[model samples]
Structure formats: structure tokens, C-alpha cells
Target: MILSVQNYGQNKSIAKDKIKVLENTAQESIFVHYNSSLFMVGEYMYYKIYCLNSETNKLSHISKIAYLELVDKEGERVFKQKIRLDNGFGQGDFFLPVDTRSGNYKLVAYTKWMSNWGQEIFFSDDVIILNPYSNNQRDFLESEVSKEDLQSKSDLRPSNSALSELNKSPLQLFISKKNYGKRDEVIMEFEGINSKKIPDGEYSISVRKYSPVFPNQKKTTVDHLESKEISPPTFDNNITLPELRGELVTGRVVAKSTDIPLENLKIAFSVPGEDYQLKIARTDVLGQFHANITKPYRSEEILIQLIDDNVDGLTIELDDFASPFNSDKVKFESFRLNPEMNDLILKRSIQNQIENAYFKVKPDTITSNVNELNFYGTKGITYLLDDYTRFPTIKETVLEILDNVWLTENKNDKYVFNLRTLNGEFNNSEFTSLLIVDGLFVKDQDYFINNFSSNSIEQINIVKEYYRMGSQIFDGIIDIKTFDQNYAALASKNDMTALKLNRQTEIKNYFRQSYGNESSKDLERIPDLRQQLLWLPNFEIDDTQRITFFTSDLKGDFEISIEGFTHTGKPVSILDTITVE
Candidate 1:
């Protein structure tokens, strides 16, 4: 609900008294390193995001979340992704669909903290996408290239095995040979140039075929450091806070009938999964609340609800997923598709189709590296329902099968539960114990006790010790595991709100083509028509740093580029060419 002017003024005063307003001193900027500026249908656009401190030119630790968007010429968003940052670095990839129109699109990246200043601090680069399957190419192929334009582009092309140095790069890239055949192993070494000391840092490397139709779209590290100067924003009461801990989800609450802001209400946020997380936050004086999700969750949806008895009178509203920055300021480049690129585009499109058909044999793995512990502690007494005698209702099941847990009804016809302590007794406290079903919080005790039974539940866990979440304290815990683990089906939908969260992008182990191993026999029948041989978004430079990869079956001059920052915050950008004959 939109707050009135008087309410907003009171909120600002309360915010000033409660929160410490931080000045925009250490401003942040983003620089994205992408694999290619040109793409076709079924091809993936790989990119790495570098969140840097503008003043120091080093990695910024201010924000843990970054946003990447693909904006079209009309300032419309084609796709948007929310990426999780690790030490000011993050990587993600998107596959171009066959239905995408051929045009020049802008790839934009920025953090929440960077959005406060404006679009000037955002990292934006023009990209060309060609779709042979679609006929909508008016924006790109409206006019033919002039004879002088073609000559100018051809004259600027680099020779074979040429190296383009940027900012007098300290590191040197070495290759074993200038030319190689298909499926040949290529080893590259990176070291200090002229005995110069190479500062330690993280870097990314990409080896892709150089297509003549594409322009010079690669951005040097020095260009960003020199161009993006941080201008501290003027002090304002409504500044966007940096996500110092984790992904921050902010929203407001208001009365359903009067549309008035509801303040100081406790809200529960649940990310339901096998390894779920439960957090609680209270709305401020302005009816706005922020919850920080520090842990990783597999579920793509989350539940948010008020934790009070008068939840039905309030409406919980969440902020929109669209970026707050204005997209009209983005300047797009005109893409003139030359007539000579027809055959090349057809060849690449066919190769992409062939490679995608055999994607099952060459699969990428989605990582599932998360903590196994549940939100509640692991030390709890678990009772398997199948081991006990069959019971009709949960009330009977708890009394007969369970040991130290007791469930009874009060005079108001509401069910209550308590955990027995070591003295073979329990306290008669007025506070209610926490109840969970399939990792979801169930506030209505009568609904769970009357609806759920031994037939639907698989097991029950009881924790006798007191557990605390946010400002609410529970006397004990009674976590019920459902047979289907269907929290949505069993959860009380009276006052709860479910939202589809833009969860962290899944990190994939990109399919690597290797001809030296025994598994190569399986890939012999599969057509190896790969234009981009290798894309390492996170490349480590160890003590004996050596990078190796095999060239694809496609013959061309591949561009090998490395972009990153050193420990001393110095930018690093190096480019070299290798021909595969």
C-alpha cells in the first residue's frame, strides 16, 4: 500500500532515529567480462561480473547480490537474472532461444548499491544476436553496409598470432605453437613480463573462434577503471542499503481495509526444501521490512507471512523484481548485417543444432553443494511412524507412539503441545511451542492437529530444548515430516503469502571437450562442431600456473583473452590469437 505524506514523514523520522544513515563514501562500479558479443540461436552467452570499488579499482565487498539484464532497443527487458556474488565476483550464462529476434541488444550489470547513483555507474555493452530461424531482422539488417565500411573493418583486422597489449599489461601469455590441427591439445603459460613481479589475483579466460561479422566488443580492464569515476550521491533518507550479509528481500505491509501502513508487525520468511531456512523480521515504523537470506536454498519459491493473530486484517506486499534504474538512458548500437555473412551464419546455426541434439551425451552438471543440516539443530529425537501401530489421528499418534511429547486441547478447542524435560515433566508456560510440517511453519495448531494424521505423516521429531528465532521464543519444537513432503498441500493458506523468489543462478560445470581420455571413444560418433572450445569463468593462477584445452573441429583464428584484477587492485587485460588449421 502507498503510504500517505504524513506517514512517510513519520517513517523518515523513525528511520533516522533507528538506523545509522551511511554516507556514499566507498562507491561501487561493475565491469562485466563476456565470452562473445555475437551469438546465434541455441548458443550460450557466458559472462563474468566484477564488482569493483571505484576509487581503489579493487574488488568491492559492499554488495553480495548482482543483477544482469538483457535490454532491447526499445528499452524492454528480454531477460533478467539475479546472481550471487562471492568476494565481488560472479558468473552466469544464458542460452539464446530459437524464437529470439536478430538485433543489437544491450547487456547491463549492476548491484543494488550502484543503483542509487544512476545508470552512469552501471556496466553496459552492446551485443549482437543473429537468429537464422526467425524473420524479424529489421532492426539489424535494415540497410546494407557501404563499400568503405567493409574496407575499414577489414583493414583493422589483426594478423595471425598477433598480441594486443592493453595498459602495458604486466603478464605475458605464451603458447606452444602458432598453428594446430583439429582436436589438438594447446597448453598456455602466463608469467610476469621482463622479470616483473606479477601480483596475485583471480582471473577468467575464454577461447572462442573469431567471427568476422562481429565487431571489436571486448572492453579492457583499464578502460573501465579510467572511465567509471565514483561520484558520491547526496545524502538522502531513503537510500538503498548495500547487501552486506546476503540477498536482501524488502517489502511493505499495510491494512487491508483502510490501506494504512501497519508497523512493528513480526513476519516469518520460509524457504522450504529438504535443507530449508526460516527467518523472522519485524516491520519498521514505516511498515517496511527487510530479511537477509545468508544461506543457499534449492527451492525457487518462498513463503512470507505475518506472525501475529491479526494477520487476516493486514496485506503483505513485496517490491517488484524489475530494476529500479531507468532503461531509457541506454544507448544501443546499430547492427548492419553484411551480405557476406550469410554463409557463415548458416554454418554456425547448423552446428549449434547438431551440438544441441547430442547434448545428452555431453551434459553439464548443476552443482548441489549446500549444507545438509536443517534449520533446527540436528540433535533431535526422531520417531518413525511406520515402526509404531497404526493410529487414525495425530492426537492418538502423539500420545501412543511419541515418548516425551504431549498434545492436548485447551478450553477454547485449540490444540497445544509441550516437550517433557529430564525430570519427567513439562512447564505450564503460556507461550506456544513451534510447530513445523515439511519445514514450513504452521501457526494454527487446530488446523494441523485436526487435519493431519498418521497416514499422511512419515515421521516426527521432537526437540526438548528451547529454540529462538528473531524476537519470538518457543518452548519446544515439534517438526513433522510428511509422507509426500508437500508443504504447499498441507500448509494453512489463511493468512500466508507465497512468492516466487528469483533464487541464485545455478552454477554449472560447463561441458569440457577432451580427446586424450578413454571417454573420447564415446564422443567420436558425436559431431564435434564447437566454435567456442573453452570458457573458464573462474580461472585460478597457481604457483605453476598452466592452462590446457583442446581445439574444436571448426577451423578458424580463436581469440584467447584474460580479464581480471590483481591483489593490488591493478586491472589486467591481455589478448592473443591462435589459429587452428
Candidate 2:
């Protein structure tokens, strides 16, 4: 929220107003609760993000998008994704790829609004990865160890978390039993020590087998609450606005000839696909324009163009979404692989391979109920092409099958589509009808009329009433749907500038296994080598709630962790252990 002002006289007043606005804005912080700090090559790393108001420590409603990234020891991004936040909560997961080498890594999470403070206030955690298949184990091995010493020397031991003298969390975990057989159902309950301090909040539950190889101390909700009380660093005159609406797409418009910024220009942008969106933005005093995409679009690229009749040889340049912050400042701790852990590593590797081999039988499903709505509301007259006789050309099909719609030339001698009133009145309005093809804006009506075949079109929609978007109004709308849905091929590359956009990450429904079912009986022969019994990345905790999940075939001690912030912004961290015989 800091802005550097170069000209003290011209922009002096504007700078003061901007600084006043930022000073009133509250800062934000993030907390990420992850399943485990240690992982094998084939395991999935699940996490949940909680955005908080730095002052109140409650869920912040300022930002709608958050980013999560996994960085290596050298600070290069290994994986990054855009998460669509819903009321300050989001969840995602990543599977460890086989090609990833064994090393110590870090997971960082932050919202673009949090960037105003700096990367130091961002949420970060250490992660240790073990890869037995790759030869990149040099970092985890002794430099002078001999070949014989690497096989059976018993010096290597797993790292353990040091016991702390801090006060325990008020939240306690209640389980029905301490031990159970494989595939047995276990129910865990949550309750607070005092009735007034009941644990009620949005929490994440993870039941993972304790990693005995390279386990690192996992930070809890309380730890984050204590460490995240930092304030915004002193501003050196750099400012970034918060994305209050949605994903913010920003750029600058400049004159093509002199490379000078052009101010007060209007730009029309469109994201083309089934869920395409159209938006309008205007350049400010700095020649920069900001547009917020309110919803998720299917297109990987966007089209932007000047809305004016004469663009005056102006061009647009989009800013990259990559963060400018340098992540190379992070330091990693050393974790050496000892020969004593070789037997345990081999067993886990074999189990992972077996579980992957039968993965096709039990695959995760994508929970997609994306409510697709027409960019324009649902009040247009639709036509089904198959209901009538087949026509060869678009002009003939529209003339014969359509009603109250026709193509005519405008004052500029350009062909444009016009819609008449349903009462058969010839509309002589000043505004032209908006033409669209497969969710893409079509400017040149002549080109589409002559080149597009009726055989390629599936349906046509006509709206006789005037339509408005932003400050622009159209007399009517002519929306056409093509069979192939390939709007990119029809888009006029001459008038539009194509730029890549970083869209929100897709949501998925994690696979869950249950016993005593018909499908479970059929897969009884397949080995159940799952180490992590259950993972709920977004679990809502009530006053006294019960959770039920069946244990896996893997027999060992599993850690149950519930970490999050309560409705009143109080930190709740509870831990317990269960043994599966």
C-alpha cells in the first residue's frame, strides 16, 4: 500500500490522497495448516489457507484470491497455483512427482493484498522430502561415508520435535478407543476444557502416519497466532491495491509511435470460452488500467482492444502475474540420511508403488458444480437449428429461420445485425446490435456473414431489448453458438491483443475409502497400503462434533491433528495419537 511519487509538485496532492486511503486500510496475514511436514515421493500434500485481519485476527473479507507456492532450497518455484478464496478460507493439495529429488523445501502462502506488507509477513513452513528412487540423495548423505557404511551403519536416526514448556491448548481430542484393527471405524470427538471456551471454528483435520525418517516440527494454529502479530513494514513509497472484487488484471496503454503512455483511453477486454466474460476498463492519469475478473473463466488467454473508433495507434501492455519478490533469502536446515533408516524407507517406497499400481481402480473425482450462467441474463429468444431444414449459408438460415432480425449496412457502409421490436416495428436506433459467436465478440459483421457456414452453427439467440454492460449500451444482441465452439479461429487478430491470464485453480473431490460396501468387497484382493488414513483439508468444528473414518490396512501409530482459528479469532490446536493393530 505504498506509492513512490517522483514529481513532488504535479502529483503531490494525488500522493497525499493515496497515502491517506492506504493508512485507513487494514493489513492482512495468512496461516496454512498442512497434513504433514515430511513426505515421500508418492504422497499427497494437503493444506488449508486461513486469511486473517492483522489487527482483529479474524477472517479478513478484503481479498478474494490467494496464492500457494512450493519453493526449493535455492528459492525457485517448484509449483504455484491461484486459489479462489471464499470468505477467507481455501484448500488445495499437491502430489509429489517421482522426478522430484530428495531435499528440504518450503511451502509459502499469501494473498496479493498481503504483498503490500512484504514477503516476510507471509506464511511459510519447512518440508522434508525423501526420494529413494532418485540419485539426488547427496544432500541427505555423509560426504565421507564409505559404500559399506551406507548399507548397515546404525548411526542414522530420525529427527524428533523437542518438547516445549508452553501452555497447552484448551481444545482436547476425545476418541472412543486407543487401538483398533485394520479397516475398523473410529470416531473422534472435540470438546473444550471450559464450557465458555468451546471450540467452534473452521479447522483442518489430518490423520497421517508419523514419519520416522525425516520428521520436522509441525507448527500449529497457536504458533501462527503468536508469530503473526507483526505490523506493516515502514513504507518507502511503494503501493499495491487490494483485490477486493476478484482476480485483478492490470496493464498500461501507450502510444505505439513514441512509446509514451496514453491517458483517458477506454479498453474492452474479453475472456473467450463457454464461460467467457466481457469487461471495460479506463486508463488513469498514469496510463494504467485495472480490471477485476469476478468469476472463473475457461480461457487461458484473453483479448483486449481499444473501444474507440480510431485507436490513434495506441497499444496495450499487460503486467505479468508473477510475484516480484525474491524468495532466495530462505535458509534450509540440513537433514542427512542414515543407514539405520534404509529398511523403513524401502518399505514405504514399496507400499507407495503398490498403492499407485491400483490407483486406476480408485481415482479421485473433480467436484465441479460451477454454476454456468449466460453473460447476459436469461431473457433472450433461442432457436434450435435442427428443428428446421438445413441451410448452406448463415445469411439464408437467419433470413428463413429467425424472426425480427436482419443484417443491414450502417452509416459507415459496414454490415451490422439489427433486431426489430417483437410487434414488427423497424428499429432505427442509433446504437448497433452486439454480435457474438461462441462467447466471443464479433466486430466485423461482414466477415462473419460471408465466411461462417450455417452447418457449423448449432443455435442462435436474439434479444430485441436494449442491453447494457458497464457504460456501453447496445440496441440488441445476436448470440450464435457453433458446433465446434472454436472462437479463437474466428477472432480477428488484427484488432485484439492476446495475453495470457492466470486463472483460479480447479477444485477436486478427494477419494475416500470405506469398508463393508459392495465395491469394497470386489477390491478386497488389492493391497491397501495407504499410510495416511484420512485428510480433511476443510473441516468445520462445532461445539461438540463427532467425525467417523475407517482406518487403512497399514498398522502403526497415526497422529490426529485439528488446527485452525475459532469464530472469535482464538487459536485452537489439538493433537492425539491412535494405534492400528
Candidate number of the best lDDT: 1
lDDT tens digits, residues 1-581, model 2?
A: 01121211111112766777876778888898888887889888888889988888788889989999888777677678788888888888888998888887888888876776778888888787888889878767646655554432222222233112112455656798899998898888766657545556677888877744445367777778778756754454545667889887776765656655466677777787776777878887776777888887668877777766666666566666566346687676455676667888998899999998988887887666577768777878899898899898878987899999888877788777888976779999888788888777776777788878889888898888888866668888888888888866676676776776666776666667778888788667778888777888777545456778888889988888777787778777766778999
lDDT of 1 by residue, 1-581 (tens): 12221222111222564334456347899988998877887999898899988888889888898999988877777779888888899888988888787888888899877876777888888787888888788887677777777555433444343344473566777798989999999998878765744557768888988766566566667678878876776436666667888888777777866655577788888777667678889887767787888776778777776777756556666765457556577677766777778898888888888888988898888877756666676867899888888898988988898888888777677987877865668767676788887778787778888887668888888887778888888888888888788866567787576777777887778888888689898887668988788888887655676788898789989988788898668888887778989
574: Cα error in model 1, Å: 1.6
Give the Cα error of residue 91 in candidate 1, in Å: 1.4
TM per prediction: 0.91, 0.88
lDDT of each: 0.77, 0.75
The ten-residue window of minimal lDDT in model 1 covers 1-10
Q: What's the lDDT of the predicted structure labeled candidate 2? A: 0.75
